[model samples]
Target: MIRASNVVYSYLKYGRTGEEPVSVRALDHVDLEIERGSFISIIGHNGSGKSTLAKHFNGLLFPKEGTVWIDDLPTDGKGNLAQIRQKVCMVFQNPDNQIIGATVEEDIAFGLENMQVPTEQMQERIDRSLEAVGLTEKRNENPGCLSGGQKQKTAIAGAVAVSPQCLVLDEATAMLDPRARREVIRVARKLNEEEGITVILITHFMDEIIHSHRIFVMDHGVVVQSGTPKEIFADPGLLEQYHLELPPVTKLAFGLRQKGLPLELPVLEPEELLKQLLRIRKGGGAC
Candidate 1:
């Protein structure tokens, strides 16, 4: 559903008092692709260009060089901008920053209003989106008055109300507590599984991405590794080189395997680790 080729983006850094503006490259020759109806994640440490690349998905920021295409439309084409944006919608890190309307229903309606969707169709979309996000009961509440997770769901509902084909969640769960983070992730997973919307989640939390079909690891503005979650986690040293780490359960499994416990290299969940231990116990192996 999305493709980028040799994409390069730079930010102009201005020095104090009339010095030359330095061109700092944020994305350097990055190339990646996302398939329709798949859940994928982009992970990196700070300054890794994850968010910069996401902006290209919806044309929030055009690449300084190369190209980004949503569906078959080039993002650089002025005439295609509108359609590209409609095809791909984004939910950023801060719900406070994204939420505009006072109430949940109104915030959702904001996007449809901007698109000039007919009144009947707009309400129908709003109700459907709210139900999808599990926020139907809170639709009348003020967004600010809701929990952080709820506010983010409102933001997601806003994006869904537009009927976007792809959802780019740029650090959408960064601010929430663990429970809230899981809530947000659950909503994203539901949307991907049931609605078949392509999901591109940009997050540093390794555990949050365990179920993703694919992962793109970025460093120094480049895609250093791209593979399934297990394939990426199987090499902890590679993640360390990029200032990333394995999920907690995987980390413990890695430590055990290193100490000659014969555990698996990358155990994604605690239950998986326990199952492996049970098998070892049945075989009379040391735990």
Candidate 2:
């Protein structure tokens, strides 16, 4: 499990030498616990502390005032920092920025190489990682040559090669087109569902968050709300307060609900909205 207790983080404002540095709190006494085999999505606008919290998951940043622990290991300590990172892998936004290897297979092997996996087991690890991300055919291709979604998949493969217990994705699909976005989401879900990797997806996209096991809404350096997608979407005012809109189909359902049609709210899927409409029509306006 990932545990953070009253964690606080701050960064100094950069300016000319003459200017005194002022501390700006990015995460304000945040307390969070992410369980094993769970898929959690954190949603917030720019600078809401979501990215900062992601960094602490793998010990990239230590809390200024509180504590962050990955499993039984404390992130504030130095003894197990490398092991903590292996247990909590992070995939950042923009596949272009994450790229390192000359080829897809090489990228997957890079971490394993650094960790010094035996040469005899290298090909097996690379092949399995590529297969998991459905990039086996492109193993020989350069990572920069792939589409945005494929490139992100390559990044994911690299993380999985280490078999981390938790995967933190900080807007991994933000750079992809709609089609590519869906593809990346599918792969993320597969990792969570099939491999039981605790997946933490941080994004502002409402559509991608609906299917998560739980959703956390952050604003102004605090987690304003958190619950299942159904519960989170049940309150339109809460979403509005955070400058978030429901998925387009869900928003349409809410509008219809307000217009004398009793459509169920927080409709997670378009088919669900369609089914509600069909049932209402079949029942002659019955709720």
Candidate 3:
């Protein structure tokens, strides 16, 4: 759904004194592709350029050196901006920054209103999006009154209300609690699996990416690793080299396997590890 080639983006840091402005590269020669209707993740530590790359998916920031294509339309063109944005929508880390309307329903309507959708169709969209995010009952409630997770859902509902083909979540769950994080992730998964929307999750939370179809590991403004979740998580040493780590469950599984226990490799979920242990106890597999 999205493709970037040799993309480079830089931020100009101006000195308060009289020094010359310095250009710091946020994305350097990054290249990758995301398939339609698939869930993928971009992960990295702070200052690793994951957020900068997310912005390129929807043209929030144009690349300084290369091109970004959203569903075959290049992001560099002014005329294609509108169509490109419609094809790809984004939810950022802070829901407060994204939330502008007083009520939940009104917030979802904000994008449709900008698109000049007919009033009748707009109401239908509002209803559908509210239901999609499981917030229909809270439609009349103020977004500020909702929990962190609910606020993020509100943001996702607003994005969905626009009828986007692809959704880019740039650390959308960073500020939420664990339960709220799970809720937001579940909504993103449902949107991808049920609605056939391409979902690209940008996060540092390793556990959140375990279920993703593919993962792109970024560092120093470039994609250093890309593979299926299982493939990427299989080697903890490699991830550590990139300043990343396996999910807590995966690390536990790896630790057990290292201690001469019979267990499956790359056990991503808690239940999967439990199942393996039960099988071993039952003599289904050797220790």
Best by lDDT: 1
TM-scores of the models, in the given order? Answer: 0.98, 0.97, 0.97
Give the clash count for each candidate.
0, 0, 0
lDDT of 3 by residue, 148-262 (tens): 8999999999999999999999999999999999999999999999999999999889999999999999999989999999999989999999888899999999999989888
lDDT of 2 by residue, 53-98 (tens): 9999998899998899888899986788889989999998989988
Which pairs of residues clash in candidate 1, taking residues 3 or more apart in a chain or in different chains?
none
Top candidate, metric TM-score? 1
Worst 10-residue lDDT window, candidate 1: 257-266
lDDT of 1 by residue, 1-287 (tens): 79999999999999999799999999999888899999999999999999999989988899899989887888996888888888999999999999999889999999999988999899899999999999999988999999999999999999999999999999999999999999999999999999999999999899999999999999999999999988999988899999998999999998888788878668999999999999988988886
Give residue 114's lDDT in candidate 2 (0 to 100). 87
lDDT of 2: 0.90
Q: How much is 118 displaced in model 3, in angstroms?
A: 0.8
For candidate 3, the 10 contiguous residues with the lowest summed lDDT are 278-287
